[model samples]
Target: MKEALLLQVETYVVDLLNKQLAATNYYHNAIHTRRVVANIEELASLEACTEQETMALKLAAWFHDVGYIYTDQGHEEESVTIAISFLKQQEVPEDLLSLVEQLILATKSEFKPKHKLEAIIKDADCGHIASENFIEISGNLMKEINAKNHKHISEIEWLQQNLVFLKNHSFYSNSAKQLWQPKKEINQLEVQKKIDKLLAKEKKKDKSSRFGRGIETMFRVQLKNHIELSAIADTKANILLSVNAIIISVALSNLIPKLDSPSNLFLVYPTLILMLFSVASVVLSVLSTRPKISNVAITKEMIKEKKTNILFFGNFQKMSLQDFEWGIDYLMENEETLYNSLTKDLYYLGLVLNRKYKLLRITYTVFMFGIIISAAAFIYSYYVYFSV
Candidate 1:
């Protein structure tokens, strides 16, 4: 008969919650009520609660949040009225029904739980806070709050509010406290990680707001200009290298063999001069385009200390995702450090550009001088040898 009554109450509450509760009351719907009942059963076993006490606890859990169907404000009183009506219809004993009412009222967070049964119900009501599903449950709560209250609290603010609530909350029963404390601490760590992420985002947004768009625009434009200039220098150097290589190849293939004959001896110095300049230009061009990278490994501590430039590939290419994320978080948290890293990136890029352009200039000079000097040498040789 007792098991039949519990089942009847469970079915009735599930139907009531499904049919009457607002869709927006996601965290307080049938699922939560069911979880509360399950939790109470677990606690009852651990604490060795009496058969009547267990039945009352389960009934209280079923009817605890039922008042949300009519109104959210002072829902506990409404829940008590509903529970009494249901118990009277079922012909439940007066004392057990009264105890169920007390348990239902004790589930309210603001009310201090007085009796052992009250403590069990209260702890069961918030059991998710110490469960592995805490994170997902918290998200549903946020969505529910947003849906009902129409308030758009930021994630960081929500986390802060939740952390305060958790800090002040405790499981009243020794069984619950012992079983849940470690898991609660784990949930707290998860909350702290979320808070850190939100803080990182806020810091990045604040930095952008403080710096204004003009500073960012200036860096972007200057960096683009530097990259374009480097590209141009590389193209010009490639052209010089190609032209000089062909000239050297033609001079060696067509003129060098002829130099053994006395009649073609005059072309020797001209061919030599052109070949020397062409080879030199090729070497310089290769040097300018050569890639250089540091193979040194960086630690997370270096990134935290702002000693690594996360903007450059060499600094983070070998690092793990966790370490790289930590580096990015550190950079995002500090505007000055982030700006300094960009500055260092730009400075190194400029240095590379300077080196490329300088080498390219020398290559162009050598090619131009080689053309003029080789033409002069050819002209004089033609006059001295072929004019006879």
Candidate 2:
């Protein structure tokens, strides 16, 4: 019975989709249907729905947008009429069939949902509006609209529509808001940026007027230091690993076998010390190259006090951009003071880097010395044993 019902549903979709303009692109293709089904399934898991509720949710979600097969204007109502007729023919229980149609109608954006299932399906349908793909999907919709009517919208109209959706749209499900909202903001910003770019495609003023000499220098010096530090870390790690490998090879190949001899017992402690130091060197090498939390964060008081470098955005990701930009612009006008602030920041960072390398140098030196001294100790003890 279930097999026959699923088969009928599939056959209906295959025939209906081909005639629909909405089914042509990313906006309303089989992919959209598949995504709706996926979201409904996730909502079911999160809501702990019953088997009947699950079936109803999945069916309603799949059939909700089928109204696009008729016309875009009032497809919601048309979809309900079609869904009811199809379910009745399938002989799904009468109560279950009515619930499916209700779920479909509730998905219409203007409808006030009266149940949790309705809300879930409604949220799932429009959930993509807050996705990273929102802009791309909107572009596809714009193309479809223009192709159908051959009407081109003004740039202002496009921007206003984008702002409305960005400001007004909300994800009903917690998961959608949490995971998709951040990406959606990025999507909105992309369109906003394109609008900004259209007005300022070419520069009319001198480059020197737009940016200060020291500000440009800060960018260059900071970037160069970052690259150099990365290379140094890599080189340090390779040196440490190579030194340890040589110690381990000598130990395993030469010294490990002599541990079984009662006469060579004095060699035990030194051999153990050598291996322990080698292992410690390798571990420290890994840590030195591993990243730590960026040192970019600085307090507002630090900026106001001229103690923090306001040159990096990571320093003020929590601050209002307007405030940070104001402070930075003020500092930029006072060129002498700004360079002093940057010099201090670089000096402190250099101090930290110095401490890290110092510790690393010690670890490598100890490992190398321990291996050589232990090797000599083992040979000396062996010679004494044989000479005696």
Candidate 3:
């Protein structure tokens, strides 16, 4: 019966593969069908299966994926329908046809084999999965998967799956295990080697991710703080400027010209003193608030050496935007460089601020003493001019 069913299937398969199948994919074409049919017949011989059992196995194998003629999925149903019709047309017995239909339905990959014949055929269909030809068969499967599903799975996922199947699976017939088990073990090792590789790849990825998150946050926070502080310093400078400007304005409007008259000559010394101090105070105020930018632009070499704050526009405004972005990304990649730039900028800016304050202190000192001395002179001269 196995031999007779073999002949029948071989006959049906030749025509179906040669031309009958629609949207017929090369991956599941005649060669795969033929291979499945051969494996089924071979597995039956080992079981010494009955004629009806053998025919049902062959019939299922041929039509198992016949539904592929219509669509990639649920081809098992199509195979069952095709088998029942074929059996009926051939005047094959009704009982045998029912068994064949059951066998076809059982071939749904997720379904566990329920009968001995079903088990044998199922094992045979997947037999190559554990054999040396596994890679070749897998390629066929990948092609079929891509063609039908329009999805491409990564090599690692496909390898993991094949390893799981071969490791967890077994065939009842002595021939399958004998012929395929050793190869399956080898296949498992190959898959493991790949899995180890993938794991290593993932580790490297995680390391890069951590570095980026940590350094980027640091750069953003520190730069923001520095900018805020600079603004505060500028505000303080502006306040000093306004205060001294008012003092200078008052002195100019009332004191200097009055000293020009000889009658006010008695007022001269004191008034001169007042004018000088007020002028000094105003100069000191201006110096304290003066913006002192570097005379020369910082260069690419300076940035490379980390001798300048390339991330700051004050440092890089002379440079092009393209150069600035490159420098920033570099600073981002090296957290040490970013910190160094910020520290340098802060230290220099602090020095400049200190100088401004020092000058301002002196200016206000001169203005206070001059004002006191000049006012005393004005009073003394007024008494001299009136007493005479």
Candidate 4:
């Protein structure tokens, strides 16, 4: 009689789920409920549960997820209410109906099972975690979440979440632990492997992004340093030019006119020597400050081949504005070409700075020795002429 009643309950619950369950309830459908029913029956038999206990467990499994038809959150309480109402109408004994209601509520994720029956149902509900098709089952659950919540989750993100869940979950009953623990551990390792691979891929992408930024920073800093050094060289050259101009002007105005007199005869050679050194210093200084523009014309072919550096004004000065813009656009589209142009610009700028500093050093040396030699010649000529 009890077996006949159990059969009737199964038919009714299956029909109700098929008719009323939402289409998006992929993880909580009649199929999932049937799996739980089969799992519970196996666990009950393994644990040597009495006939009455087994019947209560089967009833609980069928009604556990039916509450999903009405709501998603706090569905365990709704499931208990639905199960008790249906069992009462079938003239179930009050004690048996109460046990079934408690068993349904025990399936709630937050509820801990208190005894053998509750433990059996709880383990049965999550038996797929140890099943051979765990990955497929997990994927279906993810799809159900996305469909129901109207959101999206990537495969890597889903695997990470599953890894955390697997680490935290454990079977409650001794029979379940013995049967499912080894397979559950294997599933955990599989989830971990997937997560590790995804993380490695993301890390590689991030590293490439950082490398590009680092290259840009290096170019910016080096370019600024080169410009500053060029400015300093130009300023030094200007100082030497002004000092030489003043010396030449004073020599021609004040000393050269006095050289025409016999008394100033000894001063003529020293005055000429001073003027010669001043002219040489002025020439060197001007050479240091002079701008040398490249005469090589940059054609469209050179730009396409990346043979000419469009970043430097001297390289592109002869090109028309339209041509220059086109070259720049091409460089922007190709990262390698753009970096090569920048490198060429920096290298040529370094060469220019080296030439400026070398000429400036020679100019300063000429000016320093010129003053010492001219002064010594004037002192010797004055002493000898006066002593005679």
The clash count for each model shown is: 0, 0, 1, 0
What TM-score against the true fold does each predicted structure earn?
0.71, 0.47, 0.48, 0.53
Model 4 segments more than 4 A misplaced: 203-388
Over the stretch 192-277, how does candidate 3's per-residue lDDT look in tens digits? Answer: 89778887777756655555667668756765765666566556656655765676676577755666767666766765666566
Residue range with the least summed lDDT across 10 consecutive positions in model 3: 204-213
Pairs in clash, predicted candidate 3: 270-374
What lDDT score is found at residue 217 in candidate 3? 81
Go through the candidates in order and give each one's C-alpha lDDT: 0.88, 0.73, 0.72, 0.90
Off by over 4 Å in 2: 1-4, 20-26, 154-156, 202-388
Clashing pairs in 2: none
Q: lDDT score of model 3?
A: 0.72
Q: For residues 313-363, what per-residue lDDT tens digits would candidate 4 score against the true structure?
A: 888899999999998898876566777888889999999999999999999
Which candidate, 1 or 4, would have the higher lDDT against the true structure? 4
Tell me how far the alpha carbon of residue 77 in candidate 1 is from the true structure, in angstroms, after superposition. 1.3
Question: Which candidate number has the best lDDT?
Answer: 4
- Candidate that scores best on TM-score: 1
Which parts of model 3 are misplaced by more than 4 Å? 1-8, 20-26, 172-175, 194-388
Better of 2 and 3 by lDDT: 2
- For model 4, state the Cα shift of residue 203 in Å: 4.1
Per-candidate Cα RMSD to the true structure, in Å, reads 5.6, 21.8, 11.9, 13.9
Worst 10 residues of 4 by lDDT: 204-213
